[model samples]
Target: MPARAHKRFVLSDQPKKPVATAGGTFRGDAASFYLPDFCDSRAAFAIVLIAELTAIVLSIARQSAAVGFWGELARAALFLLWVGLVSAALLCWLRPRLARLGVGPGSVAALALLTLVVAAISACVSLLGHSRLVASAGTGAYFPRQLWPFVARNTVIGFVISAVALRYFYVTYQWRRNIEMRAAARVHALQARIRPHFLFNSMNTIASLTRSDPALAEQAVQDLADLFRASLSDRHQTITLAEELSIARTYQRVEQLRLGERLRVHWDVRGLPPDARVPGLMLQPLLENAIYHGIEPRPQGGTVTVTGERTAQLISLVVRNPLGERQAEREGNRVALANIRERLALLYGARALVKAGRFDEEYIVTLRFPYIASAPPAGGTRPAHAAPGSPEQ
Candidate 1:
């Protein structure tokens, strides 16, 4: 049988691009639709703190009644604290239900209802205190007149404040979503530019192999087809560590056929978890850099060592290649490195790290990211090219 006939190519014809969720948040089920709005606890805390501080400052400035500055500050702080706590509690309770309604009139209505409830509770507490004082002073008749105005004032203030807070959050979310979209677009463009260069090189390698070793050449074509199929898929989607390593190995095989005895690869990926998820094409570019700069330049090619280490919270990968004399003088390595860094930032925010540097005669690139497992497909089968056991060294 021809090598092509023996090899199976389970390639996706047209993979849809991954759709980014609004505000860079993850998509949740219907029950938790509103959770993304509350995902940023730091932002929520900051908003609450600023609002409380503003209220305190305003109260101090408007003090013409009977209270001293310190006394007024204390009162204002206590009231605002109570209001903030109550609002947070209600939001926590209502968030999931509101999320199901989405960011629409229904969600806004829910927020308004919460504010009214808080205002009513505050007014009721104040009225009870006032009634006791009026009865003690033999002026219980004034309680009804005082109660209405107090309730009205609290209701108005509560509604206005809540409206403003919700608006601010909405605007901030939109701004962030815009920024993420722009960053994703730039990353996509960079990936596109990098692909042509990679394709041209791979084609050349296969062209050479075809004239010399037909069977290896056929296998290289299959590997190239599989690699391109993946690259053509959703650029924003993630893949498992096992799948990524499989692709890298296929790429290595293609390169080895071209460079023959000049190129060597040493993979030390045993410590890495196979199920850990990473952005697609993340490792392949680094390997390409290793071959282009590290191996191709030297008359006697050097080995590219890929090592991975996994801890409780983090997954770390290190790629080390000899700094060939010619590679030291190259100019385009920054493009690929920067692309990887930006993708990492988009996917994991501050939780991911990509650092590259030189140590003596070796060029090293290290990537560290929070460990996230890939979800299995419907069939529970491994992804294409991903084998069950440890990868071939």
Candidate 2:
């Protein structure tokens, strides 16, 4: 009689363990490696799709002659989707705080939270007249005996699955971070290459003027100073089209001091969105390439024309310079074009285009990139190749 009474006591105590002893909530900042954003619409959609697939698999794997296959599938789907969506919502709310706990603890807490959700849902369905859904083979009278076992089984399964999922997220996050760091490093190196080439050319231009015309040399120095100051002051990877044009014009002024009648420039950028964002120092290198190959070599100076227009989906820019009669001198070294192409690819992926070659009697370079409006609010848009599981700062 005492053993029977003790058994009843133990059974009664089992139900409370599912919720009460699962785990405590955690808190944290955004600096730590965390789970993906379940709050995002795309992520939520992915979760739904994966859950449905898992439900179908479970139904097929656990087939039994007594169970109605369609009914079993539907119930499994309903249970899984409920558990998934509820887990997503709970974790979405907890993610920012969880970031403070660091990756190891955060992952454990997330797994515990997932297990608790599964156990709670299983307990509810079992107790609230839905025991047939949980213990498919058990009758009404036998369901109470099956309830604790069902919840325990679910909690164990949830813990294993959640651990696998969290590990996958961490691996994915690390892979993406590595790719971004490499791209950033490559871009910085390419940008650095342009600076030394530009400085050497500008210094030569300024040096030529110092011997013939001291005042013009002084003015050139000022223009060169302004150019360097503008480029150095802004540290962002991209800048407004207007700002890039301003830098191009400053370069044009410095070139004009050296070339005199040989260098002529025309601007037709009225159709362009001055606020369109582009890579910093993008235009200056193109102009320098034009002057060095197409204009400087010929005795009679030629014109360099910059034309730009914005279409519905893209911003188009064209730089054209009259080709010298000597085909050898007119041939571009193409270092600048290659550098620009690499930078464009890094920043905008395949959305950016660059083509440079001969067009009629001109050496022309055409560039096209998606139209980006003026500076957005902080944390507004994700960058190309951005790592998942972390919000942009």
Candidate 3:
């Protein structure tokens, strides 16, 4: 019995471009002074936990100097809690603006200013609380003498802690940015290798068709041009799903001309949003692999089935092709698969998956990733063609 399949298609009116978020505010417009937010929920939680632990340790160390150990512990806990709450509130209120201030000299100045503000506020609160306690104990307030020391100590500690935390976050942010750049450079190199190999094979196909079928060769050349045009375009920017599929189809057409009666393709795309963005050239390599490994070795070509499905949480694509009588898997296959896997890892981290295996005499590759809608370009206009001088071209 034949394998059952379903087909669906939904066209999009307008497809927006994807904005890369890996490097945060580090990429482009360096003249601007905005830096990305230094603290996420996890980082904030870690900061609070560390501060509390430090406070606890200090309180325990100074227990012999206090009237009672339990009383000292309670006082330490209260003081730390107050500090944590105030610091969190200040960060939540100011971090957004700081992010807009760009990571430059101006940003450093802003951070210093923020540190002073937080230190001043914490010192004032500490002095007020201490004065109230002194009054309640029937002792005249040590308004200037004792209170000044307490306030100055708290202020210095707050400034130092804030400076340290900010420095840690900035270092972490730079490390993450460096990782992303390295990954992107690796992917670009892999893509460069793949494009030349593809071009050589395509030229061979076009050469074979030139004499036997002039008109067909002309059409093939046009298709090749279009394919290369898109390939040469900005690869760092993601293209919409609709645009990607269109390129894939064009590539299939080019391959069909060379394979003739042997190559067959079936596309079953349903319920997928038009604005879904995927890495440029992502599908082409998979399809190339399908043709090279699954169909080329056999005298008679096999059918390549492409399926796409989208849900609220995820988008999935599957490509299946019949395996030949003999398996001729080579290092190139592994390299290509690894390349795709690395790209997926860099792009979506753990949220994206690429699985390839042989099942029931068919080679199948499935790609699953989180669903994210692309946002419209700044000018509200889409480019008609890929830019010239792109790496692929």
Off by over 4 Å in 3: 1-170, 173-189, 192-197, 376-393
What is each predicted model's overall lDDT from 0 to 1?
0.68, 0.70, 0.64
In candidate 1, residue 172 scores what lDDT? 59
Mind giving the per-residue lDDT tens digits that candidate 2 earns over 73-192?
A: 777888889999999999889987677666667778888899899999989877954545545755443233467888999889998998899878876765565466455545654454
lDDT tens readout by residue for model 1, 1-393 = 112211211110012212223123322234323323433587468647865796679776876355556666666666666676666666766676665555665457766875777577768656765776756886443223466677778788888877877766656555565576656656653554435666787799878878898898899899888887876777667888888898789878877877889999999887777887887888888898888888888999999999988777688999999998765544566767656665665576555667788889999988888887777888787754533333221
- Give the distance in Å from residue 214's predicted Cα in candidate 2 to where it truly belongs: 4.1
Q: Per-residue lDDT of 17-86 in model 3, one digit per residue for the tens?
A: 1322322233224322233332567757765787678767976788744345666666666566666666
Task: Give the lDDT of residue 383 in candidate 3.
Answer: 42
Alpha carbon lDDT of residue 57, candidate 1? 90
